[model samples]
Target: MADPKGFMTTPREEWPRRPVEERVRDWDEVYVPGALLPIISKQADRCMDCGIPFCHDVCPLGNLIPEWNDLVAREDWRAAADRLHATNNFPEFTGRLCPAPCEAGCVLAINQPAVTIKNVECAIADRAWEEGFTPPRPPDRLSGRTVAVIGSGPTGLAAAQQLTRAGHTVAVYERDDRVGGLLRYGIPSFKMEKRHLERRLEQMRAEGTRFRTSTRVGRDVAADELRTRYDAVVIATGATAWRELPVPGRELAGIHQAMEYLPLSNRVGEGDLVVSPLCAAGKHVVIVGGGDTGADCLGTAVRDGAASVTQLDIYAQPGADRDEDAEPWPTYPKIYRLSAAHEEARDLVTAPAADADARLFAASTLRFTGDGSGHVRSLHLVEVDAGRRPLPGTGRTLPADLVLLALGFSGPDRTDGLVDQLGLAMHARGTIARDAGFATNVPGVFAAGDAARGQSLIVWAIAEGRAVAAAVDRYLTGSSRLPAPISAYDRPMAV
Candidate 1:
């Protein structure tokens, strides 16, 4: 460890965020630039370097967290960056977007606060980029084999980059006009700026990974014909199919899925005048889910000048602190969180969170009301039990000019004819079915990420990509050298 007693001496300190009032007006990242470097060293020093680090166990990437934490504490930025990149292809993405399962699994989390592993990881990666230590690791010799990867999300990108570096010619296909899938489209600039995604894409392009955007495999390139052309294929289409509300008045004009609304804001951030049908400006916005996506909608609508915002959830509220009985130590917990979007919304709206209109865990949307013009104007809701069932005689109505179904995803988008053409089996939960090696029933094809693992964290997607890449490599070459950090067959810890 950098300092033996660092964990005992220093209390945990988080990266500083810009004052809520100041940050609410713009789309810049919430954190103050360069504020983390000052405290990251001390934060990393708090790592106990415990025997058999459970943080590693909890991470889907099995990232060398403790080792890098120690290196950061010692000011070995180069070494820390090297160790961090060993298991992860894009530490910056996980460093920013991941919820830090490692921190939850930290042995120290049994009592005191866990080490700021995610913050330190981001610091090391950022320092490496500044020092020009991150360069394309090109293969010494070409293998002369070609691989086609479907989707440009984290999984397909990871698999493509690894395969490209391993001497195979890899081409990544995306249905969107640009690459980075959700990273480019669904995520907002305030949480993490798009420059990070662009930089990584630049590195991947330089490393010899070919990209084909605005081209659907099943539609543009016939799935069967495309598979025949490539030596191997990997699917990472992700879970783009949004779950629906199936309630009365589901066909209102101003109502939309969160996927539809979030991406339009991202498009505007990309410096384009979006002709998108979904834009949240000067409207009474009612979001019907209370997860991360809901928070994202809250922030985007606030920046877009929504007249009012309200987020409704079917479940009861979580406690400010962890509930030991429901979630024991070394496991991820259900606790109250004040996300960056929530903080921004908190400042922009009225006094109490309820008055501010982002009410959580106590209500459910029953139906939408519309005028003769077919535009939504009000939303009817009823109080819900802890089980999310409606209670009698508590119905109420609120003006809602726009209704965003931030209810999250249901499963992969199988409408493109890829799954039907290939006849791949799906799990009972509706996610793609893959065996031990992430291989589908088809011989030369495999699946990973949300396409295979369902909607999940970027870290898990990257882990699945690396694991599936190893499997594909082994299948093609009859042997492989790629590292499979996590078993594709292994089940993750349940909430």
Candidate 2:
């Protein structure tokens, strides 16, 4: 431990964000640049470095948190980065995007605030780049085996990198014009800038991991054809079949899915468009579903100059502190937390009838009302009980010109015929059915990430990616040395 009494003395501190007034005006990352490095070492010192670190156990990537935390506290940037990379392929992405379940499982979190493991990880990754610690580690020799990975998302990217370094020829196919699937279009720039993704892509390219953009597997190239070309196929295509609202006036104009609204804004940031065609400027935006996607939409609308933005969450507001009996320590608890987007909305007073953080808890959409032009004008809603049954006398309406449905995804999109053509078995929940080793019903085809696990965290996606690569490597050769952090059935600690 860096300091014997570090956990006792140190109060937790996180990276400060840019002012809401200033950050909302631009598409750059919300965090103040160069802010984390200064205070990250001190924060890492707060780790107890437990005899049995539950933080490591809780992380899907099984990131060596205490080891890296110690190195970070010592200011050993190179070693910290190395430890971070041992279990995770994209620390930059995870450090920025992951919700940090590890923090929840931190021993200190049983009472005091958890260690700033995410900040330490991000600092080490960023500093590694500045100090030229990260480089393309191409395989010493090729195995003469070929693998084709579908999708260029976090899962696919992680799988591709691992396979490439394991001496296999890997080709990652992306349907979009760019390499990153959601990271490119679905995720907003305010959360994480594209430069971090670009640099990682460049490193992957240098390592001989090929990326084929603008190529749909089932349309441009047949899925069967890909299986024939490659020795093995790994399906890391994320679950993108978004759930529907199915309420009256859902077909009204100005009503769109979160994916549809978010991608256009991302395109504007990518220089593909001067302004988003579906821009929410001067419109009353009502986002249904209180998840990360909804929060993302909320932030994006604020940046686009929405007149008002209200987020409707189906679940009631959770308590400020953990419910010890219901959700004990070392497990993620349902608690009220304000995201950056919520803070922006609160500071700007965007949601008129919402809570302090701009969320209407336990609100269920009744129906949408449209104007004479068939454009959505207002949304009718009602407060619901724990069972989602509407509570009488709680009916209300909010002005909603632009309504975004952030209800989340169901399964991998089958519109491209990838699942049908491959004859992959699917779970009842609409996820790809995989064996304990991440293998699909199809002989040489494997599935992982959201496709196999349904909608999940970035850490889980990366863990699945790493595990699937090891399975593929073992299937090709007799045995393998790759680390498989989680099995196909391994699930996160959930209530």
Candidate 3:
């Protein structure tokens, strides 16, 4: 265990972010570089290493939180990295992207600030890379079986890496020109730099995991062709069919789905374009959703020099503290939290709404008003109650030259034709149907990740990836040693 009495003596100090003024000027990550390593060990020592270790139980990856915390507290960086890598294939990604439900489940969090588990994980991962602890672990011998993984997102990457390390010849197909799906295109560099992803890709390539870019499984190459050539196929195509806001004037020239706007900015960062055509410079921007994607859009718009920005949330703002009655301890809770983007918005005065923060809680969009040229000029909205019913005498209009819909995704896009060609059974919710073993209706074909689970946290996607890989390995070899963290039927914790 970590320091026996450290929990009582130590107060939690999170990894510090770069000053708002400095970070907004460039596309680099928000956190201060080289600052985490110095403070991470002390934070790790704060872990009680509880008898129950609810932190580990709550993580979708089942990350060995206590083990790594103890390792870090002892300054055993190598062992901490090993323990971290045991369940998580991509700790660096999760460390940056995950919401850290584990922290919420920490025993210390019952009455005090939780240990900085996410920061510790990231420090271990980065130190491992710097110290040359993460080498490609190529299999000793080939099993002579081959697997084709469709998509190159977190799930597909995880499954391919696991199968490759298990001696199966694995090849990942990506429709995009680059191997990473959303990680390459959708995520902003300010949140996570691309260098981390590129380094991992290099490691995977060295480990014999092959990548096929710009290859659409059902279009460029038939899905059946892959099935005939490979012994098994796994679909990890993430849920990317974004939900639409069908209110009036949604078709206006200045309005776009969050996905459509985010990728263009990413492409600009990738040097594909000098400037994004959808750049929000000098425009009054209004985002229509309150989720992570909306926050992402908010950040991107701010960086693009939006004249003003406002985020509308259908649900009322949650309280500052978790409601013990509605959401008990150890379960993920809804509370008023300030994201880095929201902090930037508040700091820059980029959002001129009545609220101190850029977000308008319990706000419902009534309609969009457009200029005579057919570009959106303003948005009409009303205050809504818990039931989303409009409140009387609360209607208002705000200047909105650009409107982005970040309402989240419904399911994997079927336009790629993979689902139809493979005759995969789908749920009414638009996700692929899978059994406990993560197998689709077709023989030798399996589905996992957002394709089967709908949109969810990145940790869940990686967990599903690892689980599906184990199931595929079992199906191929009759018996397998790979660890499966969760079953197909597993769901996120709820009240």
Residue 483 C-alpha lDDT in model 3: 94
- Badly placed stretches (over 4 Å) of model 1 are 274-277, 350-357
lDDT of 2: 0.93
Clash tally for model 1: 0
lDDT of 3 by residue, 119-138 (tens): 99899999999999999999
Better of 1 and 3 by lDDT: 3
lDDT of 2 by residue, 1-495 (tens): 898799988889999999999999998999999999889988999988899999988998889999989998898888988888898899989889999999999999988888988888888889989999999999999999999999999999999999999999999999999999999998899898999999999999999999999999999999999999999999999999999998898889999999999999999988899988899999999999999999999999999999999999999999899999998877888899899999999999999799657899999998999999999999999999999999999999999999999999999999999999999999999999999999999989999999889999999999999999999999999798999999999998966
Q: If both were scored by lDDT, which would come out higher, candidate 1 or candidate 2? A: 2
Tell me the lDDT of candidate 3. Answer: 0.93
**In model 1, how large is the Cα lDDT of residue 189?**
88
Per-candidate TM-scores read 0.97, 0.99, 0.99
Report every candidate's CA lDDT.
0.86, 0.93, 0.93
- The regions of model 2 sitting more than 4 angstroms off are none
What pairs collide in candidate 1?
Answer: none
- Candidate 2, clashing residue pairs? none
Writing each residue's lDDT as its tens digit, candidate 1 over 371-410 gives: 9999999999998887778899988887888899988776
